[model samples]
Target: MPRMIFVNLPVADLPRSMAFYDALGFVNEPKFTDETAAAMQWSDTIVVMLLTHAKWHQFTDRPITSDGSSSLRLCLSLDTRDEVTEMNRLAGEHGGTADIDPPTEYPFMMSHAFADPDGHIWEPMWMDQAAMEAGPPAQTDA
Candidate 1:
């Protein structure tokens, strides 16, 4: 079987978080969802586990980050730059926030980011396959 990744996030409101993910094109996997936790499937291999604060603490003693503080950001890849833009737009329209940074475009890729209602960052990016095959772009002085 192919190895799958499950990125777990702690959310203050389960239902609201579920809805926000749904808007960003993730499907709810009801088989693993309940009042306190939800399994949002972004792809066949990527599933995000959204757990309420209390439920999350059951698994770890570490405290959840407060609003406006971020430890890490999650990224999702799309097929095209337009898809990246559209997803970010939808995220904002569906109770999330966008424009965390200006969209970036390189010779090989394009990307944008948004934050869910709970402040978890999601970046959607698109890369050119041919450019990838050519190898990483040359490093330049800052």
Candidate 2:
């Protein structure tokens, strides 16, 4: 089986978070969803599990971190910089908050950061591996 990523995040309100992600067009995997958590499928193999704070703790014995004032950020990449902007915008429109700073621009990458309603920081970015390898933006001959 192909390696899969399961990003487990803690949410204050299960239903509200579900609605927020739903607006962004992520389908819920009912087989993996329940009252305490929901399995959000963003792609065929990438899965994110949104769990209530309590449920999150149940999955582990370690203390759960309250996102109220944390400075940590998690980055989720996308195919294009435009998609980053769109996702960050939609997040804000649907109860999430965009990062105070504007999207960052570099030679081969662009990123827009934001926080969920509960203040968990997330960055949606676009990075071209080939372009990055070339260093800086390539000069096209067109």
Candidate 3:
């Protein structure tokens, strides 16, 4: 069986967070959703579990961190630079913040970063493995 990942995050508002993730192309698994939590599927093997603060505390004794104060940032890869741009646009359109940083273009990859409504940072990126293995391109004047 293939390994899978389920990233669990604490959200202030389950519905609002669900809406925000939906805009970013995740489909909610209704069977796993309720007032206390939502399971958003990013791919066949990847899901993000959004839990209410109270529900989250039931699993961990650590204090809840406020939005924008989180230590971990989630990153997802896309097939093309265009997809990264589109995801960032959707995030902003659905009440999230885009332009966490200007889009970056290295010889091998391109990326855009944004924040969800709860201020959890996400980076959507595209990469060319061939270019990456070849190493960074020689510097040139802008």
Candidate 4:
């Protein structure tokens, strides 16, 4: 079987978090979903496990951080820059915060950051495959 990544997150509201992820294009896997947790699939290899505080606590003894602080940001790669922008728009419309940070631009890439209702940061990005394969432009002296 191919390796997959499951990002588990502690959410204050399970239903709300499920809805938020649904709005952002994740499909919920019913077989792995229940009252305390939901398995939201982003791609064939990526899944986000949204768990209630109680369910989360069952897995860890650490305190749940409700303070808008994050140690890492998850990223979703799209096929086009417009899709990245659309994701940010959907996040804001679905009870999440959009544009938590300014958008980033590069000769071959574009990205925007947003946060879910629980303050989980997600960055949507687009990159030109050909440009990436060619590597970054060589640095030049001013």
For candidate 1, the TM-score is 0.95
lDDT of 1 by residue, 54-87 (tens): 9999999998986688778888989998999999
Query: For model 2, how does the per-residue alpha-carbon lDDT over 1-142 read when each residue is reduced to its tens digit?
Result: 9888888888889999999888766789999999999998888878878999889888788866674676578777798888988999999999998765688998588998888777778788899989867777656999
Deviation (Å) of 13 in candidate 2: 0.7
Residues 101-136, candidate 3: write the lDDT tens digits: 898887579999998877888999999978877877
TM-score preference between candidates 1 and 2, better one: 1
- What 10-residue stretch in candidate 1 is worst by lDDT? 65-74
CA lDDT scores, all candidates in order: 0.91, 0.84, 0.90, 0.96
The model with the greater lDDT, 2 or 3, is 3
Rank list by TM-score: 4, 1, 3, 2
Listing every candidate in turn, what is its Cα RMSD in Å to the true structure after a full C-alpha superposition? 1.3, 4.6, 2.7, 0.9
- In model 4, where do residues sit more than 4 Å from their true spots? none
Q: After best superposition, candidate 3 residue 83: deviation in angstroms?
A: 0.6
| lDDT, candidate 4, 3-105, per-residue tens | 9999999999999999999999999999999999999999999999999999999999999887888798999999999999999999999999999999999
- TM-score, one value per model: 0.95, 0.83, 0.88, 0.96
> Distance from true position, residue 103, model 3, in Å?
1.9
Query: Which pairs clash inside model 2?
Result: none
Worst 10 residues of 4 by lDDT: 63-72
